[model samples]
Target: MKITSIKLPGDISDESLEALGNDLENNSSTLDIEIPLNELQSSLELNNQQKDLAGQISNKAPRVIYSTSPSILVVIDGEPKIQQNAKWGVEAVVNTPFTLVKSGGSYYLHGGKHWYVAPSAKGPFSMTTTVSSQLRKIEEQSKAEASSENDAAEKDENTIYKIIVSTQPAELIQTNGEAKFASLENTGLLYVSNSSDDIFMDVDSQNYYVLISGRWYHSKTLSGNWEYAASDRLPDDFAKIPEGSPKDHVLASIAGTDAATDALQEAAVPQTAKVDRKSTQAEVTYDGEPQFQDIDGTELDYAVNTPASVIRWRGRYYSVDNGVWFESGRATGPWVVSVNRPYAVALIPPSYPVYHMKYVYIYDVSPDYVYMGYTPGYLNTFVYGPTVVYGTGYYYRPWFGTHYYARPYTWGFNVRYNPWIGWGIGYHYSSGWFNAGFGIGHRPWGYWSGGWWGPRSYRPAYCWSPNRYGGSYYGRNTVYYNRSRNYNIVNRNYSGNIYRNRGGIVSRDYRRADFNNDRYRNNRNPSWSANRSNNRYNDNRYSDNRNDNRNSRYN
Candidate 1:
């Protein structure tokens, strides 16, 4: 006799379902329509008993176990289960499948036929509600499989990834304060960190798992929940962290006292230099006209000719064009013109300094000393040492603020106009000559000397080019320039071109009569002396190199 399908009452409990299956096998020889009828009557009785037990458990109200650490706990049916490991916060409970089920207001874990409740991923657990209908179906399916297959499925549930042993260390790059671990040698794993302190690398699908406090954890996504990994079952990567690597503590925990002393004694060096990784390129998206260029020092692709030329650098979007800077919180932007430039952009090294440096001088105004000819009240309290240091060559460290160091343009570059003071000049190197104004005597060879061609007594007027509707508002078209009685405003065009009020064309090549040498090579700006004096004023230790031409490209 063969039982094709067993149709039981819809309200039958999971326990009753299991028992009914058992009874069918036992009485197979005596199988008939009468056998199922007998078993159904007995199953109904057992279902009622299970319901009563469930009610009792619910009424008891799991007891809360308070822990000093961030972990929480509860007692269900007199069995204590921890939702979080006190040391590591949330962690996977032993023998519990790594599946989370959400019902009502709380999240529960499916432990075969049982349901365990926890406030979060890391849980102090307690057996609470009955198996949910969704979970019950899964459990029922598992029971139908053969015993050998069931055992194999159970083993697979505990295993996270297949381990592959490797001898080489994973190559890592630091960006946005997290280490990005990529397999440069094709170890076939990619991992990023959510926490700077707790970083792990995977190799051959195993090893180099992270151990925090004492518990082991693994994750596929950078910000994903760290599932508990058994220490005994951990892959070989954990054992391979070079002895002197910053992750030496992880090795010590795994290898115990038997860890190699030589590896531990190696000097701990911080990886400050940004590594060039092939996989770190930003995903580029074009909204309008397509313009492409490679941004130096980063894997970002930039659009330079677009109306709002944008580049994604270090996971942030920065648009630099038309002498104004804009930033966005996302990859695609309704970009906002940054009044005070972001600290992260200031930290960009010299390799990508052109775009950022063009605007750095605008923020150089201070109460005591005004570096930029305009914007009197806007002070630069963040930047330090615009000074030349001996060892690091040129240092512009931010001594005490959240601001990133915005280094002055110490290197020489030829341009007809002073980008620091002129508002109309497009900030690009190629566009500087076209928008040239009267020479401000702010030479590129060194710092600005106090002598600007514009009237010293004049106050700067904030001018903005017309927007799409031909109206002026603070935007990418805005610039701050000296507006005195001598220069009367003429008609302004819709394209933001300023025509001469007095009819004579504004000279593009207004060279300073006081300087005879070519503007490109000659250091005609008197500000170099002021910069030299100011450099010594901040730190007298570097006064000996006052005359040293080490930093000069001309020398």
Candidate 2:
């Protein structure tokens, strides 16, 4: 059934209705559903993704497994890496995805609805009415810090979840109770409507299929010995999934489809810039001494301790900071900007954490400057065959030493792709999900010198911007600067230099005063609007879908 509108009870508080309206507006990709308030019963249900509304029909308590973070990976595959929160006088579970802390011989696992308590780290956890005040304070502080970004309503007391804790690579696949199937029109495939996961069953073999990071895995039943299914080799019925259908999001994962073709085209467009060799600088800071790890199957070693993507190739260190390439003789460098892309970088496999750096390309070089460009791949969006997917499907192991260093992950943050914003974390998953507790040094968890790498800062430019097509909250929105695709990078307001200089990196006495002229000449804010020509994907179909409240699944 096509979900065009949602019906609500008339008695809903104005504040609650307002919040819901704002949420639907922000996530406009989900079709416009009219929230009509009819006199109804006590319980309420809503599914914003599929635009489904099942309200006031029965008193059955709806249960959902809302994962706090996508697969929360702890270093080892067992008990989590626990650390002492001195101020709170409790041992905090620092590694796993959930908000778990221990005090007075009892461990508390904070779910969105209720706190589950157990005596040990491994628990037959049971629902608890009371918890330590310290745990309560920690939870409150987390919510307060995230208050600016998210105002997620709490789940009712009737909400239930089967708590599963693990340190290894694991995913939580859940249904309300039992799996329910709904058929796609004209296609012989049946999809699991009750679950958030992309699960489908083939009628012929009754085999179940799951899509993760552009790779499909199939099994005989819900619980199975799953095996890989190639996207190109998938059954022809997959291509029959309609354009505006509920399960149409999966089209991007299938090879040779229109959605997949669009994604590939987007990945080809690069964010280009020209840098001054003398003024632009680079630096690297390690947790301790510089440590190196081999990029399997390549003659390259990447710096493991620092957030910077520093590579050691043939005794020279190369780093890419905000799409500009820099090279130095020493590991801890007296560095200078470099024009040549490291040859070994191309050889690094996708499974490696820094593999994304391979996409950073050096386009041209002049006597005093360098021209560089990077595709969306540098920002963790990659072309997987005919499609572009977020993050390398491989999970790189995180490094934990004096300071914890997290690697880029494929899953966990509820990443969604859109033609307008590129890729962004869902609002429900974006806010305060990573800010659960402070890291060891009293800094934000996963803090790094480079903002975009790892969990240091999860805010993508588009998430906070008022405009629909992203903004300068990250750097110049790639689209905003595309008008000057051939312009020198220094002419723009780019703060990419890692080294701290006496009068800031861009010295006032610098000869090229014309570098500041572009802003005054154009009278355009690089952070905001762009010329219509620069917006390559300004198609009427996309605008019509947004303006008329219709569901057009382009991503």
The model with the greatest TM-score is 2
- Residue 353 CA displacement from its true place in model 2, Å: 2.1
Q: Write the per-residue lDDT of candidate 1 for residues 1-555, one digit (tens) a residue.
A: 444323221233445655777787778888554546655565555445423422221111111111111111111111122233222223322111123434444655543334566565345456665656655554443333212222222321321121111111111111233344543222243333322223466656544344432335565543444464644456655554443333333332353222222112111100011111221122223433444566543356555322233565545566542223445667456554432333333223333323222222222212222111111111110111111110111212211121111122211111011112121111111100111111122212111111111111111211221111111111112221113321111112211111111121121211111122211233221111112211111111111112222322222
Give per-residue lDDT, candidate 1, residue 464.
21
- Model 1 residue 493 distance off true place after TM-score fit, in angstroms: 60
* Candidate 1 local distance difference test against the native: 0.28
> Measured by TM-score, how close is model 1 to the native structure?
0.18
> Candidate 2 — which pairs collide?
70-412, 274-489
Give me the runs in candidate 2 sitting further than 4 Å from their true place: 1-79, 85-89, 111-114, 122-129, 151-160, 272-283, 322-324, 334-337, 364-372, 411-433, 436-555
lDDT of 2 by residue, 1-555 (tens): 333222231233435655676777677777765543531111122112111211111111111123332222112223466778665678866555456777877887664445678787666567786977777876666556554333322211234444555444444444544777888889999987765556799998889887654557688866656676767778899988865465766776789876576566656655445567777775567888899998776779998887667899878888876666777888888777775665556656676777777766655455765555555767676765556666665556766676555676565444555443555543332233334434444344433333323323333421322122222211223312323342212111212111111111221111111222222234221121222222222111111211121222220
